[model samples]
Target: MARIEKFEDLKVWQLSREICRDIWHLFEMTPLGRDFELRNQMNRSSGSIMDNISEGFERNGTREFIQFLSISKGSCGELRSQLYRALDRKHISQEQFDMIVVKTDSESKLIGSFMSYLNSANYKGSKFTKPTSTSNHADAQNPEPETQNPEL
Candidate 1:
């Protein structure tokens, strides 16, 4: 709500960071963590949640930030799914699964709340205005216009 200066200022991101740490700790204890395929997938999904939130905040306007928040939320879901896999595979106890699930759900609710705040404050059409220049390069293709080619 207040002008966020650092990524830590965001409660959702802080929660995500904590979740990542818990996931890493779980990875160290679970047998699935020893398997390269499962380990890599779980770690990546866990890290993505925090990474996306920070990336979104660094993207400058509220619109870009909200989009990034959505991505972060998706990553959280992915992380949760992987956690479930670990549980179903008998790599973790039900207690462990429940603990992580609670954290993931809390993080999701926080992200949603942040998105709502941003939407109410910046979704009035005044916030999506693009810089009145060629700053669209990120989405634009090559500068040279393509000519027709009929010969195959």
Candidate 2:
């Protein structure tokens, strides 16, 4: 498997970003914009999905990354709930709600799968790894003898 150098390379994060963009579009085009409370909550939850993923990746630890990914997954669920509320309130069409919900669900599942893989993997993380150089170890083990001074 190729190394993931950044969170942006993550498929889950990419999908979360797309979902956030879709939610923003709904705000611009739908009555949901005027409903400030729901709109703000929705915005925050959607943003959290991607933000947490990036934050976790930057932490450079497998445990911390998994924690943040779990949070991001929860945010996905929150967004889905908010979508249903928006649908009930007539703030969004059924089609819009369905589409966004599907995306959020998929994002949640992807996060879960990633967390499972991390849990099962042997590699802890980059931060936990130590540098290994045979030459450095040998130098450390045997130092050069000091020269004697004749006129002390």
Candidate 3:
């Protein structure tokens, strides 16, 4: 498997980013923009999905990453709930609601699958491993190696 050096390399993070962008577009183009409370909540929840994933991945531990992924998945559900409110308020079209819902559902599933994989994998993440020492102490000066898990 190719090493996942950063959260941006993960497919789930990329999908979350796309969902964030789409939510922002809805705010800009729909009546949802004028509904300050719902708009802000939607914005935060959508952004949380991506932000949590990155935050967890940067924690450098499989356990912490999984925790963050769980948060991101919850944010997906929160955003979906907000979307329903927007739909009920006539702030968004049914078509728009359907599209975003599909994306959020997919993101939630992807994060759940990732967490399951991490739970079962032999790799315990970079933070669990000790840096190898050499005569020159190069490993000590260099940053810890990136996690070896494949991006998903």
Best candidate, lDDT: 3
TM-score for each of the candidates: 0.77, 0.86, 0.89
Q: Report the C-alpha lDDT of model 1 over 70-112, residue by residue, as the tens digit.
A: 9888888888898888888898899999998998988887788
How would you encode candidate 3's per-residue C-alpha lDDT over 1-152 as one tens digit per residue?
56566778889999999999999999899999999999999999999999999999888787898999999999999999999999999999999999999999999998998999889877666667666676756544444444444548
Ten contiguous residues with the weakest lDDT in model 2: 143-152
Candidate 2: the clashing residue pairs are none
Q: How close to the true structure is residue 125 of candidate 2, measured as C-alpha lDDT?
A: 68
Whole-model lDDT, model 3: 0.88
Each candidate's lDDT (Cα)?
Answer: 0.73, 0.84, 0.88
- TM-score: the better of candidates 1 and 3: 3
lDDT tens digits, residues 24-68, model 2?
Answer: 999999999999999999999999999999998888787998999
The better candidate by TM-score, 2 or 3, is: 3
Q: Provide the global lDDT of candidate 2 against the true structure.
A: 0.84
Better model by lDDT: candidate 1 vs candidate 3: 3
Any runs in candidate 3 off by more than 4 Å, and if so which? Answer: 134-151
